[model samples]
Target: MGKKLWYHSSCLLLFCILCTNSFAQVKPADFKYVDHILGYWRMPTKHSTFTELWVKKDDHTWEGKTHRITGRDSVEMDNMQLVRSGNELVFTIAAVADPKSGKPVPFKVTVLQSNGFVAENPACDYPQKIVYKWKKEDELDVHFKGVKEKTFSEIILEYKRK
Candidate 1:
């Protein structure tokens, strides 16, 4: 009777171990937003209104090219990596320094959409924080608080598929 009990207990233990192992082997797939986020998105910043072109490069990352098209193609920025962060997406904007000699400084970013169109991150100032909302017609609205008055801006750009 003792031997039978030991054999059954060992079998149950083995079964439990196998089940746990298989569950651990399962991995989650990366989130994909190329269809929803690709193309051009225009939003105003404190300095200028700019347009951003987002292109999907792979399953785990995307590329962004931003430019001040209102000027003579003057200002431009590019970033190649962006990863999903919890229920949102996070990316970094490289600081203006040579990567070979200087350490990389990132302008931390978080992306989300709400109430028409919105994107925000914790790095934004408290209260008014970083926010983007689409305005009436074609323009997109942006707000960032300052010491006194709340700075408001607008972005006028048309988004189209490549």
Candidate 2:
């Protein structure tokens, strides 16, 4: 019974791994609008505010940096990037401050619709899916969804163009 259970558990784990990596795909051309994601976005409050900047680097990539300010202090948040990779575009997160030195974990952009695009990194713990949606009418809507402690977790951040 013990051996049978162990074998079943191993198979289940392998299946999970395969499924996670086999998401959908999108064309590189569909990602062209990501350039509009550049410029600064901010959410303001009375005491503090959060701001993010996406700076373009050539035609294929944009460097991202975020700031959270409370009173007199401003804190730097995650540094990220969006880049074109072959037939698709990818989003990568920096593991440290010095981007050149840090190894980036890449999330493949799989779905690009009229509204926006979706990217996923199967191996990541906090954000398995990262989605960015924009319409000419207004703000950028971003969603981060993943699993946590055997449960699904999601966070949404809306940013207005500045």
Candidate 3:
């Protein structure tokens, strides 16, 4: 009788632990702050302009496209998607010039806030982290950071709402 009671207690404890872990997993509604990034943004250089347009696809997904324009020529740089997967918010990218035969890369979002989010993919060669922050209502700042040539390096791109 003692062993049976102990076994039942242990089973109940394990069930509670599993329930708590499942409840702790991330969900689509938790990323509602991501809606702030929807719209068009542009960064202009002396010779070219880089633009990103984000659109909400559904309650759990957002799609973004990036393009570079110089003179009368426009070229797509990449396609990006922010999606709520089973237990994570993933940032997936497929770049036109990707060296890995254009295979899409997936980065799991680690931080989420009202103004920004950080996504990381440690397996990527160059940029292992991508951070997006809103500086103001009209300004957006994006940082790409990783190890390059055995040294830590970062690239920042500032965009204005267009």
Q: Which candidate leads the pack in lDDT?
A: 3
Ranking by lDDT: 3, 2, 1
- Relative to the true structure, how large is the alpha-carbon lDDT of every model? 0.47, 0.79, 0.86
Candidate 2 lDDT score at position 31: 70
Q: Residue 66, candidate 3: how far off, in angstroms?
A: 0.8
Give one digit per residue, the lDDT tens place, for model 3 in 39-84. 9999999999999999999977999999999999999998999988
Model 3 residue 78 distance off true place after TM-score fit, in angstroms? 1.0
| lDDT tens digits, residue span 16-129, model 2 | 887765646566567767776788888786777888899998777889988889989999977889888677788886642234555776888888776777888877766788
When summed lDDT is taken over every stretch of 10 residues in candidate 1, the lowest stretch is 26-35
Please tell me which model should have the higher TM-score, number 1 or number 2: 2
- Which candidate would rank higher by lDDT, 1 or 2? 2
User: How good is model 3 by TM-score?
Assistant: 0.77
Q: Which predicted model would earn the best TM-score?
A: 3
Backbone collisions counted per model: 0, 0, 0
Kindly list the per-residue Cα lDDT of model 1 for residues 49-132, writing each as its tens digit: 567676777665667776765445547754434554444444444432335656333323333433232233333333223333
